[model samples]
Target: MNISRRQMLILLPAAAVAWKSVLAGTPESSPNYKMSEHWWSMLIDISKCIGCGNCVRACQTENDVPDGYFRTWVERYHVSDENMTNPEVISPDGGKEGFPEAKEDGGKYFYVPKLCNQCADSPCTQVCPVGATFVTPDGAVLVDQTYCLGCAYCVQACPYGCRYIHPQKKVVDKCTLCYHRITKGLTTACCEACPTGARQLADLKNPNDPIHAFLKTHSVQVLKPQMATGAKVFYNDLDGSVR
Candidate 1:
């Protein structure tokens, strides 16, 4: 009850240091997360999508995406009978407000959700001038903001328009597939928010994963297969007009 002034000063400094560490969030959030032993992928079943935009909203809320930028987006396709190969693609405001009524109803309308494909041979990572972007062992391509030069090489190299320069951070940013949640054995925000079950997170390394069954049965294709990026996002019933 009777502490000297020197003792109080020392104890106060120690307490302040401990409080700062907690506020800084320096402790590893997930101690058990392993970079190996898992490869992440996403499955978008076109047949199941309803163009609700719930996925878009959830991703923004989870990732704190800036206005006019998107880590993931949904596009509505209008494929006419005569031109199935050249469907009209539109995503008004990244479909963040959901699609408007089809102005003209002459074609088959479907929704396609897009995100980083986690490509095994990702061009984005290849062209990063500072090696800021890299593919993790588990197949997720991630950016190291601290090392990034904001040179926009990765943005230009990406064929899918996935990477964007963060306005505030000045770093190239893209979808991490909710890596924080995945390593803790949870699905992505978009997947969780999808009301139609259109989006499914897949672990390719897991033998018991439903992705194996889906791939075996469904006619699926990755976007820009000609690029030969080994894209992990498989779309069921992907249209020819998608680019």
Candidate 2:
């Protein structure tokens, strides 16, 4: 069969359009395409944590956490089911000093680290009238210091009490998950400094990521599920009563 030059010319543009359409339909080319199915979340194994405080110090030095405020903190919960009145909650003056010596009291106790919950439906982002707080492409919730008014509404709305107004910058600030470091292919200071490997940062987008596998193998819980913030932080072996 002989094809004329005119017929070949007529077919070229249609072929180009078809090719373009196929490319446009792909997930990578779509404007709203998200590479990961879920946002990053952290899981802390309280049983494995020894309260070394190395994580806290690393966060301070790495992120420049201010003297009076913390980007992350830790709390100790002492529980006595036998005596409801004797239940006590304790946190060291600062995560700076790490956890105190464990007491020999006749009760069960554990230490839990706290940081920005980084909720998918974050109240801080909702209440920010100026659009200063926003989620990044990688799903990290962050506050743009330049856009912040320092109104502290975000500080007030955070359920985990993670957000705080920077005393020197006079802007709202909190754990950024060490955004700068993460973007550089490095782990957060806290994660890197954790002596026992209790704190781990995992990418939820990749199914092969350890966090996705962990979430599948174990049951995890978020803080204040009743609030429906869709918190991304996860706790393994968490006590139901402890918030």
Candidate 3:
């Protein structure tokens, strides 16, 4: 059956649109997800983190993050009894590989995973001249790489040092909480890869979500609460020495 010229024209444009969607990284929409019905967040239990670098490796692989850059990472802290306020912190290769044996024995050692806080009043969004950075209604901060100017204003404005200029793409990049996955009713790669269940994806709007119960019973804290960014990542058993 041969198609007429008018029919071919219409089919060509429709096929182009379909191909564009296939090339796009994130889906236009998920069939079952309602953005308004969910407020996404993450919960990190410091006590449960073994600093094995599973989260880091998983994030890099899932997101195709460039080498020497991280969408999510881990830092190991050593707080000596002598000086509690000034802890030694280090993240070798974004903690993609597990840390070496600790030389110092007397200090308290703990691991702290870090990512984009997905702030409610994000300074990064405020600084983006082109409005490339914005927060979704469901509480995830994302960058529209197509519109990003690569001015690095958002990178400087971020207090948590989460954003980075993509070396190849020439656009600002950061953690999206695995937007593609979360919007599809799946957990973030970091949360899924955590062996000890140290990381948990949360839906604040869900009545049955464990985050509500956990928040009530646990003494949780957000990083740099004084900044008051309304960060969604909640840390349980966080140390005072953590910056």
Number of the top lDDT candidate: 3
lDDT of 2: 0.80
- Weakest 10 consecutive residues, lDDT, candidate 3? 23-32
Task: For candidate 3, give the lDDT.
Answer: 0.94
Off by over 4 Å in 1: 1-30
Steric clashes per prediction: 0, 1, 0
Give per-residue CA lDDT, model 1, range 60-96, as digits (tens): 9999999889999999988887887888889998899
- Alpha-carbon RMSD, candidate 1: 7.9
Task: Choose 1 or 3, whichever is better by lDDT.
Answer: 3
- Kindly list the per-residue Cα lDDT of model 3 for residues 1-243, writing each as its tens digit: 999999999999999999998878655557888889989899999999999999999999999999999999999999988888899899999999999888767879999999999899888898888889999999999999999999999999999999999999999999999999998767999999999999999999999999999999999999999998999999999998899
Q: What TM-score, over all chains together, does every model reach?
A: 0.85, 0.81, 0.87
Worst 10 residues of 1 by lDDT: 24-33
Q: What's the best-to-worst order under TM-score?
A: 3, 1, 2
Q: How many clashes show up in model 2?
A: 1
Scored against the true structure, residue 224 in model 1 reaches a CA lDDT of: 95
lDDT of each: 0.90, 0.80, 0.94
lDDT order of candidates, best first? 3, 1, 2
Which residue pairs clash in candidate 1?
none
